[model samples]
Target: MRERPPAAELDAVDRRIVDALQGGFPVCERPYAAAAESLGIAEEELLARLQSLLDRKVLTRFGPMFQIERMGGAFVLAALAVPEADWARVNDAVNAFPEVAHNYRRESDLNTPFNMWFVLATETREGIAEAVRKIEAATGLVVHPFPKLKEYFVEMKLAVRGEALS
Candidate 1:
């Protein structure tokens, strides 16, 4: 993850785009057109601006988040305790799995064996087990699965400083 904020250079329009796009994206044949219409901008301009934002690293990811469980799929949070010497290899091995949604490196004050964490999304519940087994085999480390016991709904949105959503 980038340590620096890309917030310094965003203009009002870019800020609006970032704020507006956090939720309620259109689902239509011409979604961009619809979105651009709502933003009061040309579709082509919206495309160009979005591309520019990505190119400038202002947005690391811009995509839809599927409700895998609702779709009869499963999402499992998994972790691995990887040695410092094998970080690269293990990271590559874990990320190579098609089921991996995203991976992160973390640390704790306690002597925890797990430092590498990731989320796995699979079409079937059994697929989570298969993915964990495959990752363990590939990385020579145990993949700990932590399935969620409860779901919490949190809606997060932010506006640029000195600006408010109208």
Candidate 2:
């Protein structure tokens, strides 16, 4: 983890720069410069501010967020209960698959259970299944791969404007 910057260190310009880039600045060749101009700052200065924000853990990541399905990739939301003693091993195993985006450790009823979750993207269901199989083999645990049943509710929007959302 990177060291966080002091909150008091951030000035109005830094805050504004973070806010402007959060929701997404612009989708053009000169996105940074455009955003900088909007905030009345130089392009290099804005870039440096963004870098500071990142270094301080104010922003985990930056750049374009894609629509996976539109880009011909598949994603499924699933979780696993991993024993505490085995959590590290299981986490590594699940994440070993190329399709696995990320996994997190969460508290659960299952003793020492760390939630192993990921998205498997591929050209077809068979490919996703194959990826899951690889995870299963690596972890030596049966993954309960519960794919999206249907689009019952898919409401995703920016909760806060000018704030980047993962």
Candidate 3:
């Protein structure tokens, strides 16, 4: 896979676009047009720029952020100590499940046993456990689930200037 370009490569227009759309998006028939107008750019330009950003991997995803728990769903963080040689197989096996929202491989820490981590979302709390069991059965590896116990306040507004903001 190709590495994503650095944020420093983003232009002023790109920065403005990222900053303006980071917050709540407009709920209108022509949402893009409305947003583009607010950003002082043409609708077509806004769409094209967003597409380019996505294609370049500058923006990993652009969509609504849903509160699954509030909507009678459950989300959990799960991990596995996948052997280096079996990384691809395990990744594919676990990600094949629809409940697997996303997964990433992390360097194993001396203190932690698990190296691969992923988020699983399901329609119910029981579904979370079921997905974990399914993944364990499919990969022949135990899935350690870490469910959220307390809520934390997090502000996710990122003003992607010509520099890293994350």
Candidate 4:
């Protein structure tokens, strides 16, 4: 059994900062500074706290979630089946491609159906297809590429609210 980490209490100020940064960071060049002003804290302090939270796993990820359609970037939704013996090695090889945003391990018949799944972002359909091909060749396994026909909605926000929003 895995041991759980100790719970850390968050003060009002910390909650405020976390809530402010939950949705997305400001798109401007000085995002931290903007977030600092909105949270009523010094820019440096905001950076420090954010770093601490990241180190502590309070924030799993903190960055931009690009609008691929608006940016003319192709989003390839894909999955792969790997033998249990090859799961870890194949997962690492597939994720080595920089275009891969993130991947997840899912339970499958081969021991896991989508033992590996990820999104590849590129400027063209052909590019994404090529990436899938390269990943398959590199991993010595079949990769099922499923390019998204449309994006109905992407719900990513998860804020622990109660603090004021600026």
Candidate 5:
């Protein structure tokens, strides 16, 4: 993979935007405008900063967080014991599915069987199994699924502030 250029340093406005948006984005017909109003900036400026952040790779993705189970869907944390040589190929093959929400490469202990971990979100419970099967078939590796047995916290948001905002 090509290395990404360093991200540009954020200014006060940019920091404020990130801080404000991270808490919870407005859900309205004019969400951006509402968000900008709360942040004491014009809608256009807020949008421009957001776009710039994305372009500079400061933010990889900007989207709503979903509760799959509440939406009649399911999600599972799965891992694969991928050989070092096949890392790139396996990563690509597993990520090819839309159901694969995110993937991470982690250092494994000597006794650990899996090295690559990922989350699979699907429209239905059965979809999770189907996605695992497809990934197994594509990568020729067993996907060990760790489904949630108990409910806990859903998500966490980090708060960032510029010197001025702070």
Candidate 6:
């Protein structure tokens, strides 16, 4: 078998592009042009860099996070304690639901049993329980729901390590 090629490395310009658009993305008719102008690069270059960053897995997502509750929708956090032997099967069963928005695997401490966590998005608040029921029935594991008590707006922005970004 051929050895896989090494992953691409991020350069100074790529680092700037990653850090520059962390909190606020341009919202103008020519948003790319505006953003590119601010970064001292052409719109085409910026677009290319963004796509490359995505392709390299340096950036997982680049978009707005919607406040679903404002639109009469509900987003619930739920989890399950999946057995190691049945992880793949249980994962498939849970992800089969249309209401599932995001799913994650968590390392459980000595006392905790819940290992799989996910978010459920539904059109109505009552739909949360129904989704939980469906997931429980499908996975044969008890679903634990954690309702959000407070919301905080936190922007995740960081300069490249050992580099003076500002």
Estimate the TM-score of every prediction: 0.83, 0.72, 0.87, 0.74, 0.84, 0.82
Point out where model 4 deviates above 4 Å.
1-11, 23-33, 60-63, 108-112, 161-166
* Alpha-carbon lDDT, every model: 0.86, 0.70, 0.85, 0.77, 0.85, 0.85
Ten-residue segment with the worst summed lDDT in candidate 6? 1-10
| Per-structure clash totals for the candidates | 0, 1, 0, 3, 0, 0
Q: Judged by TM-score relative to the true structure, which candidate is superior, 3 or 6?
A: 3
Model 5, CA-based lDDT: 0.85
| Top-TM-score structure, candidate number | 3
User: Per-residue lDDT of 61-162 in model 6, one digit per residue for the tens?
Assistant: 888877789888899999898888999999899989999999988874584788889999998888999999999899889999998988798756676565
How many Å off is the CA of 76 in candidate 5?
Answer: 0.9
2 or 3: which has the higher TM-score? 3
**Candidate 5 TM-score to native:** 0.84
Model 1 stretches astray by more than 4 angstroms: 1-8, 61-63, 158-166
- Compare candidates 3 and 5 on TM-score and give the better one: 3
Cα RMSD (Å) between model 2 and the true structure?
Answer: 5.4
Question: Over all chains combined, what TM-score does candidate 4 have?
Answer: 0.74
Best of the candidates, lDDT: 1
Please give, for residues 15-95, the per-residue lDDT of candidate 2 as tens digits.
666556656568899888998898999999988888887887767788876657776666776667676688667777777
Task: Give the C-alpha lDDT of model 1.
Answer: 0.86
- Which runs in model 3 stand beyond 4 Å of their true positions? 1-8, 108-111, 161-166
TM-score of candidate 2 relative to the true fold: 0.72
- Residue-wise C-alpha lDDT for candidate 4, range 41-127, written one tens digit per residue: 999999898888788887776787676767667887788877888767887898889879878766645655666788888876577
TM-score of 6: 0.82
